[model samples]
Target: MWSALDLLSDPELCAGMSIVDISGDGLETLGSKRHHVVSLYYARKRAEQMGVTVNALVISDDGGDLARYYSKKVTIGSNSFVMNIKK
Candidate 1:
């Protein structure tokens, strides 16, 4: 992920762009806190490349044995609308 950010250090991706991190644990062991941490790092790196800001979004449920999740927010253009991420 850091490599991807480095590649996008140019001005294009950074223009009016934002990085967001979201976390939810429900599925297999793949769904872990470490994954969220990695996601956050990548998100921040991407945001820095775009000269924008990084927002860390998180949601969790202990009851989520294998079907729980949270989402991140993404806004675009001058209108600044939001889009929901599906898990």
Candidate 2:
């Protein structure tokens, strides 16, 4: 997500609005969960600083509150949002 934000934030793009769309199950199976959360926090901060909006599409396989998690930790910007698809 950070890399995508970096690419979209390129000065040459001359984009009026930069948006990063993320779709996932919201599961972190590898590495430390703490590290991942911290990384995501910083990445969100970076996106905010870069004037980029971050949105998320969450796939809820177990009827979990993944959309709430994403809304609190992932989505950013005034227009950013998280849409959950429950299975």
Candidate 3:
């Protein structure tokens, strides 16, 4: 998550950016879910703090518990979107 913030710190890197890429993984464990939620929370917060308007490109296993949790918790903004892949 800090890596994402670091990228945003560079003007050239974040120029004209309108979206942030994130992953929701390994939701089978409590620890993973906590990490996912924390990362998403900070990512969203940092983007807002940077005065950037962005939607999340969330990738996860198709029909996965993590995907569902992410959609419910992170992608709450109307502009956000999600993708679920087979692998």
Q: What is the C-alpha RMSD of each candidate to the true structure, in Å?
A: 8.1, 3.3, 4.8
lDDT of 3 by residue, 30-63 (tens): 4544653445567667766765444334455455
Off by over 4 Å in 2: 28-38
What lDDT tens digits, residue by residue, belong to model 2 across residues 9-52?
67777666689999888653447544534377788889989888
lDDT-sorted candidate list, best first: 2, 3, 1
TM-scores, all models, native as reference: 0.27, 0.79, 0.53
| Per-residue lDDT of candidate 1, residues 35-65 (tens digit) | 5344544544455556553332223333432
Which runs in model 1 stand beyond 4 Å of their true positions? 1-4, 11-14, 24-52, 62-87
Top candidate when judged by TM-score against the true structure: 2
Q: Which run of 10 residues does model 1 get worst, by summed lDDT?
A: 68-77
Better of 2 and 3 by lDDT: 2
Per-candidate clashes come to 2, 0, 0
